[model samples]
Structures are given as C-alpha cells and as structure tokens.
Target: MGEFELIRHYFAAAPCAQGGVGVALGIGDDCALLDLPAGEQLAISTDTLVAGVHFPAVCDPLLLGQRALAVAVSDLAAMGATAIGFTLALTLPQVGAQWLAGFADGLGRMAARCAISLIGGDTTRGPLSITVTVFGRVPTGQALRRSGAQPGDLLCVGGFLGNAAGALPLVLGEREAAADVAGPLLEHYWSPVPQLQLGERLRGLATAALDISDGLLADCGHIAKASGVALQVNLAQVPVSAPLQAFLGREAALHAALTGGDDYVLAFTVPESALTTLAREVHVIGRVLEGQGVTLRDPQGQDITPVQRGYQHFRETP
Candidate 1:
C-alpha cells in the first residue's frame, strides 16, 4: 500500500474520548474540519523526543509510542484542557513494516485511551525521533497557567514525587533490583499517563497549575518564578513510592523526588479554603508564602537546603 493509505488505515482517525466535540473531517481530506465549541478556547502544545536523549534507546516501540504522545499531551493537561487531536512527525532510519505496525498500534491505543485523533502528520528518513503537536480546548480565559498562583494559595501535588528518576538506574544499567521492582520502575520510565481528567477538574479550583516534568522542586520554582511569589515545599510532606524508598533509601529518594525529572504528575495550587475539598489521594505539600524562591521546609516549617536544581538543557547529569 502507499504511504497515505497506510496512514489512513492505521494512524489517521481516532475515536473521540469524551464525545466533547465531533470531527468534521478526520482523514482522507484536503484539510480537516473542526468545530470549536462555544465557550472554549483552543489550547495547543508541541514536544519532541529524540533518540537516546529524552528516552532510552531500544525501548519497546509500543511503550515509546505511549510515552511520546503522553509527554506532548501533558501540556494540555497542565492547562486544564480537554485533549482534542494531535499531529505527528515521525522520522525513521528505515520503515520496517513490523516497526511501523507496532508503533501505530501503540499510538492508536493511546489516542483511543485519551479520546484524541491523529488529524495529520508527516514521515521521513532519519534516526527515529518523534514529534507530536497536540491540541485541546477549554473554556475561554479559564485555562490554567503558571502565572495565576498567589502568595497565600496552597501548593499540592497530584501523586508521588519521583518514580521516573528512581527508575533510571535500571534503565542505564547502573543499578540492579529484584524483578518485581524492576518491572514497575521500567514501566514508569516507559509509559507515563497524562492526567487529563484531574487537570480538567482543577480548572476553576486551582489558582495556578503546571505538571512535574522537571523534578518537584524545580517545577515548583517554575510556578514561583512565573507567579512572582516565593514557593516553599515541605520535605516531610513530599510523597515517594515504596519501590523508590526501597531502592534509593529515604534521603536519596527525596533528592530524586526533588531533582529527578519525568514524574508527569500535576503540581498545582488552590486557595487554603479549598483544601478539604480535594480528592482522596491528592496531598497538600506546602503553602505559597510571600517570597520568591523554591525552598524546602522542615517539619517546623524552617527552610532546608535543596540538593539539586531543575533540569538543564545541556547538563549531562542532574
């Protein structure tokens, strides 16, 4: 079959997730038609994963498919946007049918799960990198941003601090663990699920929002810097997974949770009055104080030193 046919059969149209909107034209058309629903403003984001850079080399194609899309879609989640559709730009050294099949399967599965569609994309020859530009829509002027946080709003995290950081030891062959632990760590590294539903729910509730891609402390610093307020995180309140605790020990675990990247969880802020209204698993880790730094607090709320900073573009090590 031709390239266009392959895309049409495998990667073109995906069923809507929440039935929020209908696609006027999905695939096999000169251009796609989308109806921007009333009261919603379109939110757009793009991300690229390079080979042996953002992800490990020789990983599962399916998992790679999942991770690539998840990371791109995460921007929408951070902004409290309901995912709509995405375009992909895939580069390959060679288009092996088996590889394309696996990649398409993985991408299709994720699109279905997220209720998104593959509106359009391009493919070419290269060293196997993927770029995804995803779009979602939320009510006008209500989508979350990094600058909305205030001095008195409470800071919270959606889930555990760092698993992707703790899992890297196994990914790089630098450390070993029991099979049970290894499996989960690798899973965390391979497949990161975007928190679309929770982010949508946080729209009006959260004063500001951003996802934890670049470590908790660093990402918090992002909110702090953007919102022009000092943000303090309490070490005692930071959540770490059991596998991370067993693998890295308490202090190192906290470091990974603080400086380690790729947790993909939502770290957002809401007024103190909304604290009790939070869902079952969400944790209120700190409060937005009148300051301009991302520091940690001891149990008594005194400042503690942070060991590592946020992710850097050129740094070889974190």
Candidate 2:
C-alpha cells in the first residue's frame, strides 16, 4: 500500500476516529477540525521518538506506539488539560505488515484508553521514527504552568520513580534481570501511563507543574528557574519503588530516582492548604523556598546536588 492507503487503513480507522470530544473532523481531510468549548483553551505539544535513540532498534512495535503517544500526551497532563485528539507522523525504512499491525493496534488501544481521536498526519519513508502532536483543552486562565510556584509551596510527585531508568540496562542487553524485577520495570519503560486525570484534579491546586521527563532534580530546576524560587529536595523523601530497590541496591535506586530520566510522572508544587486537600497518594519530597535554583539536602542537612542531574541528549555520549 502507498502512504495515503496505509494511513487510511491503519491510522484513520483506529478507535475513537469516528467521534471524540472536541474533534469536529478527523482523518481523510485537508485539515482536521477541532472545536474548543466555551471558556476553554487548546493545549498542544509535539514529541519525536527515534528508533535507536528513544527505544531499542529491535523493540516491540506495539510498545513503541504506546510509548510514543504517551510521551506527547504527558505535556497535556502537565498543563492540566483534557486530551481531545492527536496527529501521528510516522516514518519507516520499509513497510512490514506485522509491524504495522502491532503498531496500529497499540496506538489505537491507547487512543481509545485516553479517549483521544486520531485526527490527521503524514507517513513518509525514512529511518524509523514516530512523532505525535497531541491537543487538549483547559479552562481559560486555569492551565497549569511551571512559573506559578510560590516560595512556601510543597513539592510532590505523582508516584514512585526510577523504574523506567532501571529497565534501561535490560533493554540495552547490557544486563539480565529476574522475571519478577524485569516484568514491572519493563512495563514502566514501555507503557508509561500519563497522569491526565491527576493533572485535571490539580488544575487550581498545584502552583507549578510539569511531567518528569528528565530526572527529578533536572526537571525541578525547570520549575525553579521558571518560577524564580528555590526548591530544596530532601533526598530521603524521594519515593523509590521496592522493585527498583530490589533490582538495584538502595544507593543505586536512589541514584536512579534522583538522576534517571523518562519517568513521565508529574512533579508539582502546591500550597500547604492544597496539600491537605489532595485526594490521591503523592510523595512530598521537599518544599519551595525563597531564592532560585534546586538544591538537594541529605538527612544530615548537607547540600548534595549530585554532579550529574539527568539525561541531556546533546551533551551526553550514548
């Protein structure tokens, strides 16, 4: 099949293609149409995932599809937006029916799960890469921003960290893990769940918020710089999962939680009052303070912001 034929059969016919919230028109059109609700603003973001760079070259196509869309949708979650629809631009070195079937199935399942429709996009010949542009809606003036943190706000994370990072060794074939440890960590890395509902709940509550793509310390620095406030992270307070600790020792687990990237969990700040009002379980890692930049404090009250903060694609050697 040609490009348009492939999209028509695989992507355009995916679940949620017929009707989705705010999507006026979907695929097979010059432009996909979206209708925002009254007093709501559109939130849009784009993310690109290259085969060897983002995932192993021989990774499962299904997981790749899920991860690619989830990564882009994470930005909407940080803005406390409700996902409406998405566009997929897929590039491939060559077409393979089995791979396309798995990829489409994964993408469609996630689109259904998120209640987002496939709008419009392009397919081209190139190295294997997937770029998803997601669109969501937030009430006017209520969208969360990284610049809203206040000095006295409390810092929190949606869930445990380091699982994705922990799975990297196994993914790269550098290490082998027992099934018990491998299953959960591999799931975390391949099929990350975007915190869309939690983000919506935090709209008026969190002072500053962003999904943790980079490590906690590096991403927190973004909030610190954008909000012009200092953030003090208590190293002991960072949430590390038991599985991660079991796979890697406490020290290594701590290292992953602090510096490992691709968690996709929301790291946010809320006022003391809002903290009490939070309905879900969240780890309070630290608090915001007057000043600028992020600092890590140990149990002894000594500053120990590790020399390595997180992953930087350009600066790091793979």
Candidate 3:
C-alpha cells in the first residue's frame, strides 16, 4: 500500500474517550500533540504481544489490536487514570496490508470507545510483535494504589470469572464453540472491556484495587503483601457466568475462576460501609482482615484445603 493509504487506513484514528483523549492532533502527522490538563500527572504503561506467547498465532488481527490496547489500558485503569494517547511499535515477519488494516480497524474501534488516540508508532521487520504504550492522567491523590488495603476492608469483584479458562478449550479446538457453553467466555478473552469508570469511582471508596489479569488468589496476594494484611475470599460468593458453568462443571468452574487469568475485572477492597454504594458496580466477595495471608473459604464455612497456587508467568502458562 502507498504511504497515504497506509496512513489513512491505519495510522489516523481516534482513541477511546474518557475525559479528553483524542481531543488533540494524533497520528498521521510529523509529531503528535496533546493538551494535557494542569495539576494532574499522567500515568504511563506499556505491554508487548508476541506471537505464540501473549496470544495464539491464528488469533484475529482485530482482536489482537483490541487486546493489545485493552491490556495496556488495564494498567491505567488500575491506577484510576483516564485515557489519553498511545504509540504502537510493531514488528512483522511480512507485510500484509489487509492484516494491518484489520488490526488498525480494531485499534481505532477501541480507541474511539475509550476516548483515546493513536499518537505515534514505529514499524520494523521481525517476528510478529506489538508493543503499545499508553498515557493517562488523574488528579493528585486520586489514583488508586495496590498498597493501601487495611484490615477489615470489604473485598469485591466486578462481573464473573473463569470464563476465559473455560472458553480456552473452545479456542484451542479441544472443544467446540458452543455459545451456550463458552460464548461469553470467548468474548471476555477476546474483547475485555477495561473497568476504567469503576476504577475511577473506586478511588476514594476502595482501600486498594487491581484488575484481575492474574487469578483471584494470586492477585489478592499482591494486595495482601503490599498492604501487610490478610485477605479472606469466600468461595460461595465467587461469581461465575452461566456459560462458564456449562463448559466446566460446578467444581471445576469455581476452581478455574479462582485460578484462571485474564478476567480484567477489578478486584478491590473498601471499608464495610462501601458495600451499599458500590453495589451498583461491584459485587462483594470477601474481606481484608488483620493478618498476613490469603484464605479462601469453602461452602461449609471451612477454609478450602490448600488453595491452588495462582498464575506465574514463566513457571506456568498453560
């Protein structure tokens, strides 16, 4: 494709809009510019997607584009910062205008939805890889931190879990794509909507918060260690989607939900009084008590026997 065609088709587009993202000149120019607000500092994060590593090689380019940005945005969401701009660095084994078009289309779709913008990026020849760096801003003292959990705080999660793991079998051809069984789970994995608004709202109410990219048990331990408090998660209260239940029976469903990754839902802690207000956007699942570990309670009120260990990037990736 020609330079102008490439620019028009893929480079120039609006990003997701939360506060004022994509309000200024973005990509397709000599230099992208921004009108950053005064007093608020921008939070920045980056993530890379490698073929056969972060995602399957056969995955759709559109979903890859969406996921690449969504994953990076999740980091900003965890920080309670609004969307701003992003730059992409892409490495490709071969040039395919069609593939790039679909990827850009996906990127633009998400950018507009989230009010973000594609500011700048670079291209190189190599194995297929994409690195996206995002910037967001929040008022001073408003950004949430992982190290703020205190004793006696309520633990809550947005939406259900384990759908991705339950749906993995379908994506991998180990099972069929039965909508009744793993449809929503597939959607959760393909196009996870970052909970930016919820994270922003949680800034004051939540003692600590983080999106559940890793499993609940593992991510909760992050907060526990950071805050120096123990977290107790009630298994009965753990929410699972109907589709996930159908794909994996009750026992396995709960286990996968607890130990599965890529939920993108926010797992946060708030004071006891926050239960009522947060009810609109959150589901109370556990509590942070004074201690130094995480405990999962089974149905009979007895602590689960040796909770399954959570996600470890290098050691475990199945």
For every candidate in turn, the CA RMSD to the true structure comes to: 3.6, 3.1, 3.7
Error of 1 at 8 (Å): 6.2
TM-score of structure candidate 2 = 0.94
Decide which is better by TM-score, 2 or 3: 2
Among all candidates shown, the one with the greatest TM-score = 2
lDDT of 2 at 116: 83
Give candidate 2 misplaced runs (Cα > 4 Å).
1-4, 305-318
Which candidate do you rate higher for lDDT, 2 or 3?
A: 2
lDDT of 3 at 316: 17
C-alpha TM-score for every candidate: 0.90, 0.94, 0.89
TM-score of 3: 0.89
Residue 150 of model 2, lDDT score: 95
By descending TM-score, how would the candidates be arranged? 2, 1, 3
lDDT of all the models against the reference?
0.80, 0.87, 0.78
Better of 1 and 3 by lDDT: 1
Candidate 2: which pairs clash?
A: none
Query: What global local distance difference test value does model 3 have?
Result: 0.78
